[model samples]
Every structure is written in C-alpha cells, then in structure tokens.
Target: MVRSGAGESMRQPVRREERDRGEAAGGGNRSGGLVGWRPRVLEHKVRPADLRAVGEVRRELRQLLSRWREPAGEDLTEIATLLTSELVTNALVHAKGGALVRATVTDRLRVEVRDFAARRPEPRAATADGTSGRGLMLVCSLADAWGVRSHAVGKSVWFELGGGPA
Candidate 1:
C-alpha cells in the first residue's frame, strides 16, 4: 500500500491505540487534534544552542497531559517536567547536533530526548564547589528508572516517573 494519495497530505505516523483514543477524546481529525492517542506521544525538534527549548518541552508535556484529561497529579507533572528539561538540555548541550524531545504517557509518564551524539551520558563526580554535572544524578534519584540507548547516528536519553507496566 502506498503511504500517500492524490489530494492527500503526508501525516505523521501514529500508533493504532492513539488513533482510537484521540478520536474518542475529540482530539483527532474528526475534531481538533490531527491524531489523538492515549498515552499520548509528542515529539519536537530542538536546537541545542537554544536554552529555551528545555522549558518549551516541559510546557508541551503539561499541555499534553491536560489535553488527555489524565488524572495525573501535579507532582507527577512537575517531576516529569524537570526531568525532561534536564535530558533535553543535556542533549542540546552535548549531542552536537539537532535534538528531539519525545514525551510518552502510557500507564506512567516517560520523557526522552534524542540527539545525534554517539557517546553515552554518565553522571560526573560532583565536588562541593561544582556548579554543573548533576543532571543524571537527579534523574537517578527521582525517576523510577532511567537509561540511555545508543543509535547508529546518535543516542537517546530517557527517564520514567511513577510505576506502570511496560
């Protein structure tokens, strides 16, 4: 089957479950959203040089949860936001190329940043006077689980908040 058609516009690929939920929630092509899915997934391109993208990622995450009408507590949202900022900021500063932030809400909340950097990130030894090098440490302490995966052209840094099945 072809991915496009006459008078048809190309669209982002979305999971099946997302399509149903988005339609049911009035967030799909039938209404407002182009593709609505529960455990809503959203991604945005980032310029590591721009420090502001971090907050923008966080804000978008908040808006997503709100749109889903998830009963997620503020605490959940806050932690998710903070961790997202750290990961995205790290990617922009270190990834050495364009980055993308993806927020996935399944049974739990997860935020991941993908960058074109091949090196894996590790928490550096922190000294009392150090002003940097604590991002991953915070993720470890707060997230239920977090880790990185290497890609041929880059890597993705991710963290999960709260508990839920995979």
Candidate 2:
C-alpha cells in the first residue's frame, strides 16, 4: 500500500473488480463519479532506467484499449500510447528510478506515471533540429487534460484523453 500526502493508503495494481467497487486509486473516492459507473484500472511497473519497459507498457495499454467492450478506436489507442510513452520515458530517464504506471478508464482514459522524484516536469523549448525534449509538448497538445500531482514520496505525471470508452 502507498500512503498519500493526505494520509490515506492506496493499494497498488487495482484489479477490475476492485475498481468496479469504486475504490479509491489515490486516496479518494472516484470524485463524485456516477453511481454504478465504475472505472476500469490497469497498472504496470517499470524498473529503474528500463527504457525497454516503455514499449512493454505501451503494448499492454494497446491490449487493454483493444479489449474494451466499447470500441475506443485506433486513434485513441495511439494517442494514449504515445502520451504514456512520454511520461514513462521521462520518469525512467529523469528520475533514474522505478516508476508505477496506472491507467483508469471511465468516460475518458487517464494514465499516470509516478516516480520517486520530487521535481516536476516542465515543457521545454525544443529546437527544430532537436530529436528530443518534446514529450510534454506532445502531451500538452494531444491530451484533453494533463497535470502533475504531488505524492508523499514523489509525483505522478498524468494525462487524459476524452471520448474514450465509458
């Protein structure tokens, strides 16, 4: 269990059944979410400095999106995959520590990457010739909503895509 800044304990790797009960993924009830309308949650763990885990997590996310009873379409899967890749890569590269990835599906798809680093991520100015430093930029442009939440140990960088499976 992970203790939040609010002193509430959250269990990691919430299962489908657990999520359906409206259990808090981050120390709070689904935030006035609709009754009986629970989210589907999935989790992945990336080892320290394991960039290969990025591709593994992306593949898992693709499988989850594809398994949705309601079609999320290829575009959503791609966008979510891309944003997740960015966040996971950042966590692995910058934090130089392990990361926990969580994906929750409600009316939208929200993915979060939690790392053991206090410093938050910021969008950088990418030059035309730069091959990197555009992760947050893509997230800002592509995600319907995105933000960073401070945790007791570190922070969670998250992004959401609207028009996702209900």
Using Cα atoms with residue i matched to residue i, what is each candidate's TM-score against the true structure? Answer: 0.72, 0.75
Best by lDDT: 2
Model 2 TM-score on a 0 to 1 scale: 0.75
Candidate 1: segments with Cα more than 4 A from true spot: 1-37, 164-166
Candidate 1's TM-score: 0.72
Q: Name the lDDT value of residue 140 in candidate 2.
A: 86
In model 2, which regions exceed 4 Å deviation?
1-38, 164-166
Quality of model 2 by C-alpha lDDT: 0.84
Q: RMSD in Å for candidate 1, one decimal?
A: 11.3
Candidate 1 C-alpha lDDT tens digits along 23-54: 76874453234345436788999875888877
Clashing pairs in 2: none
lDDT values for all models: 0.76, 0.84
